[model samples]
Target: MMIANLTGMRSFLILGFPGLSPKHYGPVSALLFFIYLAIAIENIFILTFVIFEKSLQKPTYLVFCHLALNDLTFGTLTLPRIISKYWFGDSIISFYGCFTQMFFVHYLGSVTSFMLLVMTLDRFIAICIPLRYPVLMTNNIISVLCGFAWFIPLPLVVAIVLHALTLPFCKSNIIAQCYCDHISITSQACGENVKIVQVTTLCMAMVCLLLPLAFIVFSYISILVVILKMSNAAGRKRTLSTCTPQIFITCLFYLPRCFVYVSNTVGFSFSLDVRIFLILWYSLLPAAVNPIIYCFKTQAIKEMLKKRLRKTKIGIKIQLSY
Candidate 1:
């Protein structure tokens, strides 16, 4: 039975994993449920801690704060409905609703790439131009840049979705992937306009992914050169240590994407199952792991978290004794 609202927009049935057996749906949904919870808890802890901690009110930490927020938003935006799909056999999403999800998915993804670029720039200045770092990249400047990162891609995303809406989705309402994305939705579109939409969206995605990535590589190379030239061993160690988390997280975010792009370019493609697995792996894994990286790598945050954990343990013990 097809359900539509007063607007007469048809609903799309999301196939979380097209190849998975019906019997496995329960386990898959349960796994995703836990991952969603982990993403939520870890990022929420980072956001909450950053907001309340006075000592962590620097531009660099604030950049991390923005990243944590982005991860949380991205997970929340993409996960719940799919979880519903597998857990309750509810795969239907309204046409406009699917488009809305698609827009935010791409938009948040663009913002994350830009934010990583911002972080690279932040590190570059702090390491290479230490003397002018204070005057050059102030908190307010970083704040404005982060604000721009989040909002600047809005129009492009909107335009892409708008163009997609113009396409006639007259046939299949079933999306093969877990969620509504540009590729999945546009594939359902009929007519010659489909190619145009695909090409345009691909071009936009390449720009969003590559441009910032180029700068990140350049900035990191410069940072590496600067680190190598440092005479003080401890200083170099400390500097590299600070960058470890970002480098790791950046790799987590970008490497899989680069692999997929390269595979596509070389006329090689993954099985649908592998492609879907890679998508979920790269998209959600980094968000869930980022907080752990920051917690352990940054001395201040690590110490603070340890103190909080100890306090919690003590409180639990006292409660149990009563």
Candidate 2:
């Protein structure tokens, strides 16, 4: 059998959903638009709050800022293209464009998993080794860690993208999801190299997803032991409260991701729509919920929001009087 040639310009048609109709696209697009908007606004607010509030300059809050920025970038890189696909029926993406999208999607996702690990370490230090935390998690140290989280994934993802580019994608031009990703794009290639792609992708997933997850679990376990040893109830409550948001966000990210990887590795049969939904859930849901969790759960952020609200109200009242 002769495989198609990959010598010319190629484009992909992103089928937003497998069974969705033209009539359903409108409502679905609107819903996704609002979700994207909400994710952007919430993350931007958190990022701005942390940047402006001098009191929030601690290592822990700085990690929050980093995560918020990650969420903002992740949502921006993904949702607009997807929204356009459903809203205007513009599903065609150029060859390079699809690869670019795939690169960033995996890159930022790996960065986020590492960021969660960083947060877990922050909490572990604050709770388990409180005396040394001030010395250990200095601004400079946190800066270096955050830089590592941001840049470390670049080379790995670049290697993956380079390998993917070598594969001949002449078999199909239709992506069965709202956006491009490593697995989705590579699966369309026509060659025996598919197994290589799958194995390499699974390896990347283990490195990017499972490694950080293990660190997070270990950090929390140590922290839990420390919390249990603490005799003061109030102190225990405060510590748990501070750690809750990160824990929730971690679960939001890793649980679905683990499921997707395990299912793929085991050849579990999931419907096309269900797989798409799982991908969207793991990718978008954490971005939407992270800021909400931080704002509602973190006392400092609540106070900052309240203070800002009061200032806005006072400015409005003065304007009306004038």
Error of 1 at 296 (Å): 1.0
In candidate 1, stretches whose alpha carbon ends up further than 4 angstroms from where it belongs are 1-9, 309-322
Candidate 1 lDDT score relative to the true structure: 0.89
Question: In model 1, where is the ten-residue run with the lowest total lDDT?
Answer: 1-10
> TM-score of the candidate numbered 2?
0.94
Shift in Å, residue 58, candidate 1:
1.0
Tens digits of per-residue lDDT, candidate 2, 1-322, equal 2224665237887876888888888899999999999999999988888888898888988999999999999999889888998898788888899999999999999999899888888888888888999899998899899999998888989999998888877776878888999878887886788779768976986798778888999999998888888899998888899899888988998888778878887999799988898899889999999999989888888898899899999999999999
Which 10-residue window of candidate 2 scores lowest in summed lDDT? 1-10
Taking the tens digit of each residue's C-alpha lDDT, what string does model 1 give over 1-322? 4443333347888877778999999999999999999999999989999889888878888999999999999999999998999898898898899999999889999999999999888899999898999998998999998998887788888888998988877666777788889999888777788999999998988788889999999999999999999999999999999899889889999999888888999999888988988888888998999999989988788888888899999999999999
Per model, how many backbone clashes are there?
Answer: 0, 0
Off by over 4 Å in 2: 1-9, 263-268, 315-322
Tell me the lDDT of model 2 at 246.
Answer: 85
